[model samples]
Target: MGGSSLRRLNARLVTVGVLLVLAWGGIGYRLVVVQALEADVYADHGLDQRLQREILAADRGTIFDRDGRELAVTVDSVTFYANPSEIEDPTTVARLLAPLLHQNMLDVLDAISGEGTFAYVARQLERDDADRVIAARLPGIYYFTEPKRVYPMGELTGHVIGFVQADDNQGLEGLEYQYDDSLSGVPGELLVERDPHGRTIPQGEYQVVPAEPGSDLVLTIKTEIQFAAAEALQRAIDRTGAKGGSIVVVDPATGEILAMVNLPTFDPNDRSDADPAAFRNRAVTDVFEPGSTQKVITISAALEAGIADPDTIFEIPTTIERGETVFRDSTTHPSELTVTGIVAHSSNLGTITLGEMLGAKELHRNLYAFGLGQPSGVDFPGEASGLLRPSEEWCAVNCVASTSIGYGVSVTTLQMAMVYATVANDGVWVQPHLVKEIVDGKGTRVAVEPLQRRVIDAATALSMRLMLEEVVSGGTGGYAAVAGYRVGGKTGTTEKYLIDEQRYSEDDVVASFIGMGPIDEPRVVVAVVLDSPRQDDSGGKGAAPVFAEVALAALHQLGVPPDDR
Candidate 1:
């Protein structure tokens, strides 16, 4: 009996020992698989929970006028953000931020209570307001310094300087859009470790790639002259009840634009509510029939081609008939006039007679050479290449006649100013430019060189200048006379063309005047164009006065002494 019982007990004990050993082996294998084979996977999972990477914004560049006046600048601003997961009470946080940010409480609450890990409470806050938020010491609330673009001159240079988008700080228009790459600096990055509560762990896993700043632009604009031109243009528009207007002042010798101003402008600092039309750099973007201003080109072409001289006689009837079209002067005039008289009076019929002598090919060539039917080469966005049909397109007699008197052609104010600048510069057409220099982040300065080419002979330019002088002295542009300066310019009054109707509006007209002063040695060329002035107003009475006011102010600002004084 003892032997059988002992044998059974020993067999059971052996079975239990074998089962225990197998279980221990399984446990050991499981430990090895988890600790050695999948160590990297678990470590990465932990890092994903504790580490955060953030982008740092780089500072934008500044824009300055020729006299070092700051037109556009970047300033330090703060952006408020919240960790929704870490926020203990979204309602309390929203209530605290509502008044400071000028946001509705409900909106703030929704943002803070969102499902996202992070949410922006406010962006680009003023320093004082951001400091107040920090002093409140609200948990889960933080702020980071960011760069903000601002225009100090407000609406003075709004069109030219343009503005940046509020959401991403990207350029939207004008020089800002054209030179965005140079103005936008390289962004930076930061890596940091955080705790479960979303607080940065001190001195833990920190790395930063520093940001690089952008280059500064120095413009050719003169601030005082720009102000004067803007004020004069605004006054003209208000006085005449015109829709809008533009003024451009250029240095003839250098072809550097001194001032470019357009009315109905907006403040770049706060442009979100501005009309889209106010954002356009109208002097370069908008075009109109140049009216009698085109006569300067015609007369210059005739004189240059040797087809006519200043005294070339023409029997200019008050009304000229060509097939189905009939052209008439602004007013009834005598039958005969010299080329000089024709240009000074801005006679449409007389200008057509000159065009007949030069023919379409010669006329088109001269207009093209004067920078007509082309972009003004300004460093601006959406610059227009004005409409000028090719010489071959001038098939009809009306086409030839209309082209001569600025009817079949359109030009930007900048182009017309450059045309007169060409004459003032003695027939050498220097391409106009706005930027004067670029200052890099490392403090390196680079000067911008302008493009130049010959368009008309110096002798022809002199004759043209003398003829234009007659215009301001006693002809159509009499109101453009600047006291103590020898003024020379032409007036243009043209019926506005309706694009949809494809016909000229009898009641609406564009009044413009282009002039250069101190004719003996011209220094500045000014162009003024008023859109759709009252019917009683014409180029001589409307735009010519504006031209005089701006030209005199510009000449004075440039320190050019009066020639007649």
Candidate 2:
């Protein structure tokens, strides 16, 4: 009986062992089928459920002035990102990143544990903060490089260099916006593979198409001249207690703008906190009612039309009758004034009488020919084409007479400078340029060419120059005279615009002066306009001094020998 029972027990043990071996073999076959036969399908499914792809931004271009000074540039910065799936301790990660990123712990936790596999913890982190984040080494938290634009010069050329947005590299104002496409280069791409632990595999096959940096832009502005002009105008505005001011200096021969400055300028580096009005490049944008400064154009037109001679004598009077309005002389001279004396003295009565000979139609035509009432085509944004009503819109003989003295029409400071430059350059109207050239990423240069046109005959320009020289030699713009330099210009003080279209307020007036140096062979033309100065200030007192200061600065820098020397 014992032998039979032992044999049965041995048989039962053998049966159990065989059944266990068969079951194990079947499970192994199923595993081989799932892992080896359908490997690619399972891998794709896993990637689709947890993997994501994003863009890595490219660096922007560098902006330099004519002197190779850095105006705008892109710098390397760190940005923090998170992967919620791999965070071991959400509270610990939040606390670690909060102080470094200057973000609340709750906000960091929300970003880390959000629905997406990837989320931004902080962008544009400072160097110190980036180092702290890297030191923390919190799971699922990391940083990569990005770009930001840096403006070195504060408000010196803020209007010229312009500004860009902080988040996206897009130009917001001025030349930056005008030349944005050339500055913001094409962005590149990067691909990464992450493991179950949310760590990027070091050796993962990454397809990185390196980005192309944007081409560098070289401006036509001379940095030194720009700084000087800006500083000078700022001083003038402060001293005169004027509302604002603008000045432009142009090379009369070549028409290249040497310096362009406007007061109340903003610091481009901190443009985010500056006033919006300070961003205006007023030299090219603001149009004002140019007073007696326009007599040069009228006299030139009259001479060009064979209407009057430089020696033509017009009997001077206290006032002149034109239909209903009476145009009077600012001075109390009661003697006869020659055409030269009329221009030299800036006699509104004498000049209007001379313009009366041209009539409204011819006067308006000449004004249009002088680049007023139209765009000067300077390479900047928001340029204004000053107002010059058509001859058909004139009310009476006085309307025509008023325009002859530079009252009815308006012009930008740049346009006025160009007008004087044209006269100085013998009537050839050259278009102004801000950007000189565009150098590609590979150092290939694409030059920006300028345009030139003829505004009047050379003979007419010469006659006008002589008359303007008299204006400064012994006339209204006497303060603008340079000791050794033969200077010629005109002074203009116009009543400020009445916003409510009511009676003129004695409080507001725009004082301006436009002049050129070394009248014999003019090198540069300067135009300065100061708005709403305090007290009873005229162009001779307020704007003429500024013109003289800036002109002397330009002369000193240009190394022109003074006439007195």
* Winning candidate number (lDDT): 1
lDDT tens digits by residue: candidate 1, 226-323: 99999998889889989999999999999899999998899998766989878888899999999889889988988888888999888887678899
Top of the candidates by TM-score:
1
Clashes of each: 0, 4
For candidate 2, which ten residues in a row score worst on lDDT?
49-58
lDDT of 1 at 375: 87
RMSD (Cα, Å) for all candidates, in order, is 3.7, 5.1
- Candidate 2 off by > 4 Å: 1-37, 44-58, 78-145, 192-204, 500-503, 561-565
TM-score of 1: 0.88
Question: Candidate 1: how large is its RMSD?
Answer: 3.7
lDDT of 1 at 2: 100
lDDT, candidates in the order shown: 0.89, 0.83
